[model samples]
Target: MAEKHFKYVIVGGGVAAGYAAREFSKLGVNPGELAIISKESVAPYERPALSKGYLFPEGSARLPGFHVCVGSGGERLLPEWYTDKGISLILSTEIVKADLASKTLTSAADETFKYETLIIATGSTVFKLSDFGVEGADAKNIFYLREIDDADKLVEAIKEKRNGKAVVVGGGYIGLELSAALRINNFDVSMVFPEPWCMPRLFTAGIAAFYEDFYTNKGVNIIKGTVASGFGTNANGEVTDVKLKDGRVLDADIVVVGVGAKPLTTLFKGQLEEDKGGIKTDSSFKTSIPDVYAVGDVATFPLKLYNDIRRVEHVDHARKSAEQAVKAIIASEQGQSIEEYDYLPYFYSRAFDLSWQFYGDNVGDCIIFGDCSPASATHKFGAYWVKDGKVVGAFLESGSPEENQAIAKVARVQPPAGSLDQLLNEGLAFASKI
Candidate 1:
């Protein structure tokens, strides 16, 4: 078996891996000292694009164009960049075994890698319907968007099944984005979810109402309060229909499932301390094991701002957490101290000419503000979550650059929430001032 050793190794080539590499370069990592092992054939690109622009029928995004750092308005690190930095980009290598105690990782190809320090950036895997024995879930063209390869497959399906009926089974970020993408491609689209409103984990009823109305007006079918119980396939083993738990079957030329995702932590399951389905980590992203750290969706670290532990799966947190982990590593090496990670949860999505940004915790009493009418031409609106007489979260749809920044500040500052009438009257103005 072939063997390699490096001063640093980051497992899983995803958003976190890319950003961590950039951070390492920034901190003056020596050539040939660091290596990144990934199962993906290509270098890490912005994952969020897989569900957004990548699905666009025209002017769609492609590789090298949306690589790491670009998503955060930084320099794009293409494969050449890794080569220039002398960072080993071990693409298409899946680490089948991770021995934390020996600081070793074994690839599926029987290659072994030893590292002085390790950063776990395995990210998450999509929940497949087949896992639950959903009948006929294995049919062709039944897609899930988690990686670039998955997006590529969906794009091919979209072309082959042009102007066909598409069913999206999920109401979260992927479901909303993919549904919009299919609709944009002129496909008759229908969304299926078991919740009364989309993004139930974040969006309030008022917020969801505006989106549901807008999507309906745009000719997209919204089927809520039911789950996809099974699928139907043609003689060719291609999905032709979706059977819902509510006893309704809808014809579909393509099916996209985005129910949810679980962190990829099985390799180190027994060796690492897990919390809430992720590896438990300190504010610096260091796991319980020595010379080991975890970041991205796999690490549940202390949310210093909220005084709690959280595992954020959003791209924003993924980028920031990777940077934090690298900073912690470099600081420790230099015998210096750096501030702990203080993350303010941020999430956003765009579809059908509507864009929204959310920040901070979505807990406590939610107060709707501004004009959220789906029929309105502007369709500008926002919401605030008031907890303990303080605004803990803010959401704004169709906000300008400055306006979005203002709401982000409102969420971070978490100022005292005044009277309901006052807040409603002030609306965006309230955030602008803050």
Candidate 2:
């Protein structure tokens, strides 16, 4: 086995790893002292682009363009950027074993890596239909999107099954986005989910209604209160139909599964303190082990705004948390201290011509406002979550940049929401005033 050592090592080359590398460079990291081990052949790019613009029928997003920092409206960092910074990009390397006690990681190729400091940013993996014993789920053309390779395979399927029918199994972020992408590719699309409405976790029924209606208007079929029980494959072993639990079947040339995802923390299981199905970390993203940290989808850290401990899986948290962890690391080296990671939960999604942003926790009474009619010329509307008479969360659809900023502020400040009727009448004005 070949043995190498790095002063600092990041064990995943996804959004958090890329952003952490950038933070290291910004903080004057020494050349050759840092290494990022990634299973991906390419350097980290924006993962969200995979399900959105990457599958577009025209002028889709491509690598080098959607790379880290760019996704957060900063300079794009290419693979060469790592070389120029003297940060080792150990691409196409999967660490099969992580021994935190010895500060060593062994790759599948039997390469041993010793690190003085390690950052775990393995992100998450998608749930597959086969995991639930859905028969014939492994047939060709049945897909899940989590990595660039997965997106590439999906792109190939779109080309191969042009103008064919697609069934999206899940009504959450992936399902909604995939359905839109398939529809954009001019494929007949149907969405199936067991939820009463799409995005049941975040969007209120009123909020989901507009999107469900909008998707319906785009000629996409929406099947609710059911799940994909099984799959039917043709002689060529390609997915031809999706059998629902509700005794319905839909034709599908390609079946895309977007059910959900779990954090990728298997390698460090039982070795690290865990909470909420992720590695537990402090506000600085420091894990239980010394000189070890976890970020992105795998770190269940403190949410200062909520006065609680939680894990956020979105890109914004990924970028911000990585930066926070790196900053904490550098500060500790200098015998200096910085503020805790104070984060306000923010989530957003875009598909077709509509974009929506949500800020803060979504629990509490929801106040729906503005024109949410799917047929309206402009689907400008929002929802507010008021808890204990204060606006704890805000959701806005088709909001301008300024309007979005206002809503973010509202969520952070958490201004007292007067009356439900007042909030409904004030609408965007409520956020703007804050």
Candidate 3:
């Protein structure tokens, strides 16, 4: 009933939190009014290049060593960035509960920070394979490659395995990327994918074949359609074999488990409305509790590309969605109208010698156009023009001059009638057929 005092109290100082705060400041709000809480001990940076150094091994200064980072663009925070912005950066802090009804965030230290509005950008953690009860699953040799800590473990394990053999489970983006890095380190690497094809959800069968052959050519053993029931270890507590559902065993000294990651929204249980591993938000990124909004991998909202359902996970997804969250906070402050946030989902991965780029299609209905075959190296580029049949979703590789433009416009919205047909020409364009 009274006028709320605080402007914003953002939890989890990752990309979303920092970007939301920067946006808030652009709206003329002072930094002293906002609280940035992060478990990482510095301001948020970027992570675009962390894997590069670990993959390259020549030890370039551009790629230093770090773990558990909430940074950006290969660099951590300068400390002065927050101070200059007048933001109260709380590091090594964790928010245990959201007292949404009281408009407060309770920390583990028995402190409550009152907020007129709150943003939760708590990201995600790697999914561990230990649940399946692989023998020696919790052993020191097995690691989930998610945070910087995982990367460090991977680096050490790869070095140790250089004298022996290493295995990676699940052939999704992370697994594939790590596979390439391990191979680069001269470790005899083997990848175990549950699915018959690589990245079955993201790429078409053709694209998958291209990558399969690519990784195989690099001397990495590729095993498909194998569901690993668990792991095996020697008496020394070192991983020695990986047991498969199909009854095959792999010998290895180091194991990198990259099954997947789930949103770290579990901490908000009972404190916020959510389905799955993310908090719910509306068009304005506002939670059911007034004055509280959610963003990043921890938040969910109807994304048009996802058929207007709350979707989570991805770097660009967080940035674009949080942009809307920031705008929502400012609009609510000024009594201005707010617009819904929707984006075409996109993701990428590097495996062996191939780079994979993807966009849209959470449920997989789409049309492919290009030399998407593994037998031919001609079409390093692949494109997809998808529609709900009601609306189109387009995705493409970074190349393909004309196709890139078409996919871009189609993602914003389908072109004014007939354009979809032109994109779907059944006749061959190179044959001079009309």
Query: Can you give the lDDT of residue 431 in candidate 3?
Result: 15
| lDDT of candidate 3 over 228-338, digit per residue (tens) | 777787787877888888999888888878788788876667877886557888867787777777787877787755566665687677666777888877887788878
Clashing pairs in 3: 45-71, 45-72, 46-71, 46-72, 46-73, 67-148, 68-148, 386-393, 387-392
RMSD of each: 0.8, 0.7, 4.6
Tell me the deviation in Å of residue 28 in model 2.
0.6
Q: What's the TM-score of each model vs. the native?
A: 0.99, 0.99, 0.84
Span of ten consecutive residues with least summed lDDT in model 2: 125-134
Give the alpha-carbon lDDT of every model. 0.93, 0.94, 0.67
Measured by C-alpha RMSD in angstroms, how accurate is candidate 3? Answer: 4.6
Model 1 lDDT tens row, 236-310:
999999999999999999999999999999999899899988999999999999789999999999998789988
- Candidate 2 lDDT over 1-434, as tens digits, reads 66999999999999999999999999999999999999999998989999899999899999878999898888899989999999999999999999999999999999999999999999999888788888999999999999999999999999999999999999999999999999999999999999999999999888899999999999999999999998998899998899999999999999999989999999999999999999999999999998999999999998988889998889999999999999999999999988999998999999999999999999999989999999988889999999999999999999999999999999999999999999999999989988
* Model 1 TM-score (2 dp): 0.99
| Candidate 1: Cα lDDT at 151 | 88
